[model samples]
Target: MMMRSKKIKLLSLAILSIGLSQNALAEDHWKLFLKNAYIDRDFDNDAVKDTGSWSQAISLFYDSKFQDTPIDQLQIGLDANVQYAVRLSNDKHAADSVLPFDAQSQKQASDYAKFGGAVKLKYKENVLKVGEIWSDSPVANIDASRQLVGTYLGGTLSSTVNDHLSLELGVLSKYSARNDDQFRKLSYTQNGNKIQSDGMSYIDLKYRVNDQLKAAYSFAHLENIFNKHYVGLEHNYALNADTQLNSKVRYFNVQDTGSIAAIDSQNIGVIETVKYKNHTVAAGVQKIVGDAFPALDGYIPELYFVNWNVTGFFKKNEQTYHFIYGYNFKDYVPGLNALVKYSYGEKIKLADGIENNESELNLIGAYNFQHDYLKGMGLQYLFAKYDTKYGNDFDENRFFVTYTKKF
Candidate 1:
């Protein structure tokens, strides 16, 4: 049975790291922190006929703490992570190719790579975690846009019951949709060699109703026959001091519970099949300048709403809209940045048949160099255009350079 569930998740992470090192040796207060990151990407598409590929990644993180703990009343911790990826080009396009395939003319070098680890146990507002993490739910996150590293084994619980509420719950296993291995269920096939059943489950909520409003909600249950729901709302105001007025709205719903007869026989010969309810809506607005903007500092930068692999651009009843404006040059170039964005969406078919609509435009420019010979260097440029009524129209361009250091 999956090797006794991997020896009971490695004996429960070695008994939670020996009970957090015996509670930091009976309260001598210990702490540790380490982080590392690296990434690379390249892609292109002319309606997928080949000419796109490149990937690389490395990551590591570990955190530990035990600040005076007896049975919880303040601090206690353990967080761990380890990740790796290498697939530097081998070109074999078209397996749902949205561009990027040619890893050395199909001889496929690198041959995919992955390893994962996770452990979390905290006590000052509860937290208990387990192996193979990384599923920032909103319908499956952790797709750092390629370079592999997608994980999920199971067990998660987070809590914060005061000062504006928070809660999260999870259960996972059966995820290998391209990498970050570990699967004994959750099936999806198409060249990773067809296998099925990865029933998913999730619950999340966040609320903070002061200091400019906030809200979030979610529920998921895929593989017990798909049922998903999410709702979000955010608002911030300060239309002065360099302008600020952020707003956000989101909603999504999906349903189907005929108990999977092969997902009702592949939606019955798909022509964009419908009969299992779907609805999605998104809203966005961003404008900021000076004194801030490191990817807009923390929320709502609208690259299709906080990357759950580019958050659904209209695909339920279908509707989407986004707009962005940015400029930061306090002294002409301290971390130079500029941006322009526009998006439009449409896709409707309430029990009919064919008709797909989509429109998009994006342009971005970035530069962040704190000159010490390029401190944590980063430079980027991107352009995108897509138009569709039924077919034929595409344009995408991207170039990025990134570097980091931490030890």
Candidate 2:
């Protein structure tokens, strides 16, 4: 514990110095985010007690791009971030019970700090980054659903093949979860036991068919656990100057590998959206085949599916329908928007032969200050209600305040 704390302090100091330095030679950018989240959970089954939590988080990021480098067409970049989160509510017992913490221990997770940094080398249209990485892709993504963000330790390379084609590859070995202060080997849980993996590697390609169509494919292997393949397509059509239509389709296939137990599943999703000036509406459907969807150890967010809501709706044999409505109030109040989303799932089959159903509703509102005094400040609020037949029900509220500055 002491060693971890010391490392955090050292990293935090280093990042803070870089962010606050006014005379830095490189072109630097900085951003700070603040968030508060609260949850109220209930259970239909009495054995599982109801719990709740309220937490606060602060995050700071610094990025520096060196303008002058010895190598022509080669750019050097440095990126770093530090995050701190703590339980702010007086209900310590409840907070400890429900907070995002190590599965093995909860007492030591009341408050924690973490830091990560990465070095980037960009030459022409190719970029290479090594160290702590924050990524967002179809197969692998960092989770920002909580007060803090999850990150991976790895190296990634991306290249632009042409004007309409690109490729990306990465190998990751360790990660820190949203609430964790230290990194650990990648792993997943099975029968209440943690099964560690050697590492993970992935490659993806994207192609633009035309001005209105795009396609992507990705494949990932979690050393000795499972192999996954994903394909996606997107299209856009303009109905008129003030109206547009967008459509998307995505598919995923997972199969077990090596000595691990069978981890097989398939997912299919389709979505359509229509936008008319300031109003937007969307509808989607998704299905899960074979076994339940398997996730990495650190509660990673699976953002590739259309039915990703508060519950994720990833149960085996589950079929879900999703709806969304959004309105942009920019004309009335610049930088303001609101959205409502709902998801319902049925034919969910777990180990039990019986089928179950689940549903979720979400409401979100956000506003960014457009005035000169607070141009970079923003505020957001979210409310979610998740009800399930085979699991606990949750009612959650989250508030966030953010500010960004560049120098």
lDDT of each: 0.49, 0.81
Maximum-lDDT candidate: 2
Cα lDDT for residue 273, candidate 1:
10
lDDT of 2 by residue, 1-407 (tens): 68557756775786668656746644477777766666555555677655666777777887776554898988888888878777776543433323454445434356677788999999988989999988777888988876678889999999999999999999988888876777899887766767788888999999999999999999999887888899999999999999999999999999988645578799999999999999999999999998888877777879888778766688889999999999999989989999999999999997759889999999999999999999778888888888888777767666677665554
Off by over 4 Å in 2: 1-12, 19-22, 42-47, 94-108
Expressed as tens digits, the lDDT of each residue in 217-242 for candidate 1 is 87867664556566677777655554
Candidate 1 has an lDDT of: 0.49
lDDT of 2 at 392: 77
- Give candidate 1's error at residue 174 in angstroms: 26
Candidate 2 weakest lDDT stretch, 10 residues: 91-100
